[model samples]
Target: MSIPGEGHEDVRADEQKDGRKAGGYGLHERANPKRHRVIRLWTVVHPSVLGSTTLTATASEAPLTARLYPRNWRGDGVPSFKPSGQKGWPIRGQDLVRLSADYWWVIGVGVVLTLARFSEAFLVLKGRAAGLPLALVPVVMVVMNVVYAATSAPAGALSDRIGRRPVLVAGLAALACADLALALMPGLAGLFVGVSLWGLYMWLTQGLLSALVADTAPEDLRGTAFGIFNLATAAALLAASGIAGLFWDRYGPSSTFLVGAVFAALAAAGLTLRRRQA
Candidate 1:
């Protein structure tokens, strides 16, 4: 048999004579025809080798690389696939009801906590009211997010070690304190303190609640549990914001924050009572 690329030189010569260049040796569409053909043939012949090499390199270099490269990595069993039917509203409604009944306290905490915290936009408004410059108002959220990002990992780790309830209680307390500071204290310093506390509250509570939902939910109903929990909390947040806006327009910022503080206190008390009962 003739060598695979033996006629490539003659083909190039013909192309040149016909006023067409043989294109450069690259992997793109305009690459040398013979080299591209050889690459395609090699891939066809050793498809698994090429794919596995790429996968191995990717896994080895990915983040948390040490964990990715397991010493006993193996694929011995065949994966089972099944066609699942869509769940109807009736079935989903029944699940929602069951989840509500079984995990009422978890759902309750989520609702009350959401109600206790309005949109962060209110915080920016509060900062503005406190004499923060229009341009520098964005700094309020920046500081809050910085504290939140800095502490969230540590808070999650602590909750994992100590348990979710106590950590959540502390978070509610932080929220109450934040609301108190925002409502009662004066000036930008107070705004920053409240903002920081708000960040701490978020860092402490948000992840813990998700972990709590996962812990309490049945494996088969985890997705349903999350769906219902999110729905309830979202509704509560909407209502809370509406109420806060009413208070802001009618009474003032202090009343708005004070209302949030009251709700936070009530939620914390409810959680403590629930824990004792449990």
Candidate 2:
């Protein structure tokens, strides 16, 4: 009988053993409890200097799928599928529609108030027209600014306790009185008093408007809300001055002041209506 070659049989047995080791480790760990051995599936092939290929199997506790490709894969070892980097922040049109009614109310009231107030340049001109000495005319602004600086913090604090709407309505009503004082009275005294009242209105409304915007806006979007609020009121104020100037040139300063009074009165009435609705 012809006998099988011993070297060929040994090589075939070794190949079979390596295949079994690879398969068993790929599915689960080894059953040796004492050694705590970890088994992993691998198809390891190495070419030796002798021009022979060798196959080998080994046990390892860690998986190679993620760790082996650090740059190409995610932290968890899976290939990264997310896009790299991010774009800069931008305010979209959807931001306008997302603002609430109360926020819009605050912005609207601010715009109306700004329109009625007009520019302090007109206030200085009114002082001069009321027979104020040219040098003393600037005192009108000084007094108003002093009053504004003093009362601004107090007005904001009072609104925090009593609520923003009441304070804003009161300020608008005071603004109406100031406008009427400037229109109807005929002396330096009227200019001073009207300008003082103007300062009072600034104290009452400006900081409070900021607070209302903060209260109504989402925390993340508060800055954007304030920017919108300021922009709307600023544009209104510019338009209002142009309109007031037209009235002043055609009908006189009294007509301009009278119109401002009317606007302030209307704003107050609207605020009252909104409060009732709320």
Candidate 3:
């Protein structure tokens, strides 16, 4: 009884009522029970297809992106690849040995400097010995951290204007003063002074040392350089702390800091000599 296209028109009207259009598919079309069921079945059958395609496309573009914007990839304005225009994986052993040989002075300086840096726990213990109330002992660390945060930016800026060597020498001098104050100076006054100097020393030297490493190392082997630098310093720090603890138990806390002061002075002198030579 219907015209030839009347049934099709009726189906289209029903689809429109269901919020779907004849020419295009969208959220409304997907909301249809039949279409939703078919889509779910297709997804189940090809679960990884979409994911694999997306991953492949990203992986393909990553190298090109790294090449185009090497600094962006490195995040430190250093290029992402070898500097000699050679393209290949670097030989780790040979490169590391060469790096160590070329930068042995930096490594040696780091070791000497770290040997003067005993654990902060010793500082807290020193505060206690200086008659800081048990409850207020934590104030020592708070004061140190505050000074460290305040001075870090200024110290880094100053180093940028002058040089890393001068800043690092100043830091070593600060550490020597801190050690002397903690060891020889009396009372809570000395404790606070020592803690503040300790913070200043940290702010002046830490970033500059890392920057020095970055400046000296090749772009391709920076990770290795940093790794080795950290390892050397960490080992020295461990040994220094252990020696300090030994001195604390036997010769007493004052002797511990005196020994630290001696090391700091020696390191500072070494740095000065190197600076003059350069």
Candidate 4:
């Protein structure tokens, strides 16, 4: 009796009109005869690394950030700067300055996220085990995609309105929590929650990067400013997609998401660097 609905369980209980098990039948389960009472190590391994899939998810989303931030280096003339909003924000000047490397930190986040994308596949695999109707899986997936699309933009926008550093850092921190949840839960619901929040955090790039450009580039030089920023980001994404795939195939899925958490930490840490320097 190795748990019902799983392997090695040969009996089932069915209730009758009398409220007693009458038509109970034997469930055909092909037991692994290596049943020397020793549990398979792989079974244990899964619980230990359950959260690994989320890390994989996070790693793969890294590259998108680079594409959104883009640098332009060849434009000329100073764009007029008007004082608006809070006067003390660091990014107040990042709006008009033009430098590719100025936003390099965003590129780094992209690398880790691109790697996390592979985690998406593993997350799907987890779905297969849920015993959900095969016919409904496709529908569930479509619905979920819509949910993600709806949620991502707002997360990024919220960060911008509130403050870039705080939003970026908070999203990463929430991701860290989501990753842990992925590792600990024993069912599909865990994957759903983790992946959904993961998507929301991933969505932060568009607004965050847009603000990065706004804060740094001069109005007169927006063309050159955007060009240079985008180029570097594209390069990081190219590397992240290729290498992150390799990492996922060679190691386990969870390893990919784990790497994502590390990169997120590094990015969060890097955000601090600008404040100290300024």
Query: TM-score winner among the candidates?
Result: 1
The 10-residue segment of model 1 with minimum total lDDT is 72-81
Model 4 lowest lDDT segment of ten: 21-30
Worst 10 residues of 2 by lDDT: 38-47
Model 3, 1-278: lDDT tens digits are 33465477887667667764544456566569797788888979686888888788876454665676666577544455665675676445688666844366788888888889989999999989999999999999999999999877777679989998898999999999999999999999889999999999999887777887887788768888888889899999999999999999999889999999999998899889877877
* Segments of candidate 3 deviating more than 4 angstroms: 1-93, 100-102
RMSD (CA, Å), candidate 2 to true, equals 29.1
Backbone steric clashes in candidate 2, count: 1
Model 2 Cα lDDT, one tens digit per residue, 129-196: 88888988789889999989987867767887898889988899889999998999888778878888
Candidate 1 C-alpha lDDT tens digits along 1-278 = 23356687787767676653334333354556777788888878797888898888876442442345443233432223334667666346666555634376888888898889999999999999999999999999999999999987788688879889999999999999999999999998889999999999999887777887887777668878888789899999999999999999999999999999999998899888988887
- TM-score attained by model 4: 0.51
What are the Cα lDDT values of the candidates? Answer: 0.84, 0.81, 0.85, 0.56
What is candidate 2's CA lDDT for residue 53?
25
Please identify which of the two predictions, 1 or 3, would achieve the higher TM-score against the true structure.
Answer: 1
Q: Candidate 2: global Cα-lDDT?
A: 0.81
Residue-by-residue lDDT tens digits, candidate 4, 55-74: 77776452443445434211
Clashing pairs in 3: none
